[model samples]
Target: DVKVTQSSRYLVKRTGEKVFLECVQDMDHENMFWYRQDPGLGLRLIYFSYDVKMKEKGDIPEGYSVSREKKERFSLILESASTNQTSMYLCASSSSGTGGSATNEKLFFGSGTQLSVL
Candidate 1:
């Protein structure tokens, strides 16, 4: 079975501290994504990588960045944490489908990291 593990399930940080959210997938998936879930905003994509050292900016990438140095590991970096950035951070991985399209791929999500910024 495919498993996605997040380093932290709950976290609290100061407003200006740098936060690192780590994720690792057991399966050799080619795509990894970072998403933040808010009360009314739903799941907003922050960053995604299709391959190692390759990253694509998603909908809300202003305050975030990602690193995929290995096939099974993806890290989300919050350069300067802010109050508004506090939310549930989720890491997901999916294997590329027939044409490398994600439309039909099954996503495996981590338990999630609930970050509280003060």
Candidate 2:
């Protein structure tokens, strides 16, 4: 089965520290995405890479960036972690298959990275 793995399930850091969140997918998927899940705000995209060395900013790409040098590995970088950034972050990927469109394929997600900043 395809699985997405996040570097951490929980993390706490002081304000202004930089943070790196790693995500790896077992499936040879070409699309990877990062999103922050907040209580009332729902999942907001940060960044996404459709192929290695190529990326695009999502809806809420401010204060964040992404890397996808390898086919199966993608990374999310928080330039300066702040208290307001504390939230549940999820990494996901998709591959073409029985599903009609990429969206229909559905994203396989990592449990999530719960970041806490103080």
lDDT of each: 0.94, 0.92
For model 1 the local lDDT of residue 107 reads: 88
Flag clash pairs in model 2: none
Q: Residue 89's C-alpha lDDT in candidate 1?
A: 96
Give me the overall lDDT of model 1: 0.94
Candidate 1 runs further than 4 Å off: 99-104
Model 2 ranges with Cα > 4 A deviation: 96-104
- Over 1-118, each residue of candidate 1 has an lDDT whose tens digit, in order, gives 8999999999999999999999999989999999999998899999999999999999999988888999999999999999999899999999888886767598889999999999
TM-scores of the candidates in the order shown: 0.94, 0.93
